[model samples]
Target: MGKTLALVVFAAALLSAQAPAKKTTAETPEARAARIHKQAIVVDTHIDTTMMLGRDGWDFMVRHQPESGENHVDLPRMREGGLDAAFFSIYMPGTVTGPEAVKRALILIDHVRRLTEQHPNEIALATTAAEVRAANKAGRIAALMGMEGGHMIDDSLAVLREYQRLGVRYLTLSHSVNTNWSDSSGDKPAHNGLTDFGKDVVRELNRLGVMVDISHVSDKTFWDAIETSKAPLVASHSSMRAISGHPRNMTDDMVRALGGKGGVVMINYSVGFLSNERYEAQQKNVPSAELPRVSWEKIVDHIDHAVKLVGPTHVGLGSDFDGTTVPDGMEDVSKLPKITAALLAKGYSEQDVKNILGENILRLLEQVEGVGRQLRAAASKSD
Candidate 1:
């Protein structure tokens, strides 16, 4: 009887081992990522879709594919990517300056404003952080404008004021070439950083409630902007130099200093900015099509490095979409969900992820606006 009982027990154990395992009831990484991403107010601080406007007559209403030429962010892809807001850049090449720069900037702003009005159901023009939240709440993507070069302002405070009135929220001090007042990373150091007039520009922007974007500026200019600006500055579309070793990318010390002062560095999605090897290929005059692709995971790596250096509050997204080549797998705005998913896998908490996505920049905007209010009030009193 004992041997028979033992045989029966052994048979049951064998059956239990052979049976399929029960599925877990816990939430999956993908599902959790989606949930958190959907719940977050996603904002991309830089995109060059406006540049595509003059060239190919880019329409915000149309859904553009990844394979399309320099057409990255659009309304449909933004919705698919859960992007609640984006800053459409008013771009002008370094060669295009003076009246032409001013004219082009005005035209681009007009285009974005008109497009937003034309697609009222899908988009809303936003200037303030409050307006951005309101637009997202109403289930519409917020269309924000940023000037890509200080030269576009025509060296006039009145023009800058008009730009602010027309909803230009940030002004990148320089582009690939140095402006009269500010030095650019891509050019020979002309002003040695920022001229006296450049510092004045920073001050005026603070008074006008426009963010001072230090993306393409030289290291000296970056430091000067940080020092002169009353409000916290933004590196609208820059990555980390420690990771990619590009001069266009910020150093770890720059990141730390920027974060220490309440400023944020929005990571650019350019593969060359995220990977040194790819950047080397770019320097060798390799064509964009032939430029070796970097893993999209490098995007998250940049975010991770920034977060680790300055905590999540100082890091945000500023995909240089339509302006530069991105890493593989992040073909267009549609693939942004992968970033949130990867962050989750890297053990970022939901709130941290949300902060990095948009909240941090929103907070920065609100603070900048508050400072503007104070400055204006003081000016009124002085008068």
Candidate 2:
């Protein structure tokens, strides 16, 4: 019996020595953050890289850090950030009008397409939710397009339809100024909301499967859009006005209304949108370098507020990269994992994080496309 016990003891010690250390339940926030960021389908619904491509001759193929150059997004940074998908904005300033605007819009669209074409192995143009998933599965970034203003369509549904045909998926009804059909938050209220034509624009967008983005629209216009859209709405890049009190940010009521309709509000990383103090400082001509850097915590605060008001299903990231000045820690796209880490640190569940990262937008896209397919089928049958 003593010899048998000795043999068992010897065997137990040998096994203990051979066994790998058991992973602890407590994972370092950084390690956990990296895992979540990598596993999630991180999609930014609004990026102005298309404009950068058109103006700066920025090379999308090479990674450009913010410190090294003016570029905020590029292929390498996206990969480093674990950004699975992004919608490059075909943004025309509100001041540009007439055929020149349309020409510029077309040029930006062509630029985005050319970038994807040139970097076929690195990025793929995704027109549908399935395509986005496929791109992610194949380890390629899904590149999608969104028109930043309805003015680019030039008061014509035909131009809008043509943009849809050319793979423009979402249209922000206005930019910093009011369009003919829709009032902008940054401009004096003209129609008090969407004009008669604006309602029609929403309907046409619903039929075409293009998302109606209300980021820059006036509050009245936001309600008009909520009442008008058949499909779920998307605030392509806006934060909580209740948090920052900025006109560009959505009010609590607006956030709830959007969430009620099964839409998602992609939180913008713009310092102006994320913090009222920073915004006011900037308005007062405080040198950007003199201004206090907006913390990652503030960004998380916006996300938390939105989630509290609308639940996690309605919140997502929209960074607004290459379009606006980003916050301190999140200087560029490559620092995106910091968001996941911050969210995790706040005790957000993995599933909720997944939804917020990309799944919510993907589900909304699929539903919007499904509606479009049904409309097309019905029209064909009538014909």
* lDDT, model 2: 0.91
Q: What are the per-model numbers of colliding residue pairs? A: 0, 0
Alpha carbon lDDT of each predicted model: 0.91, 0.91
For model 2, what is the alpha-carbon lDDT of residue 367? 85
Q: Write the per-residue lDDT of candidate 1 for residues 210-262, one digit (tens) a residue.
A: 99999999999999988898899899999999988889999999999899889
Can you give the TM-score per candidate against the true fold? Answer: 0.92, 0.92
Per-candidate RMSD vs. true structure? 7.0, 3.4
Off by over 4 Å in 1: 1-24, 55-57, 286-290
Clashes in model 2: which pairs? none
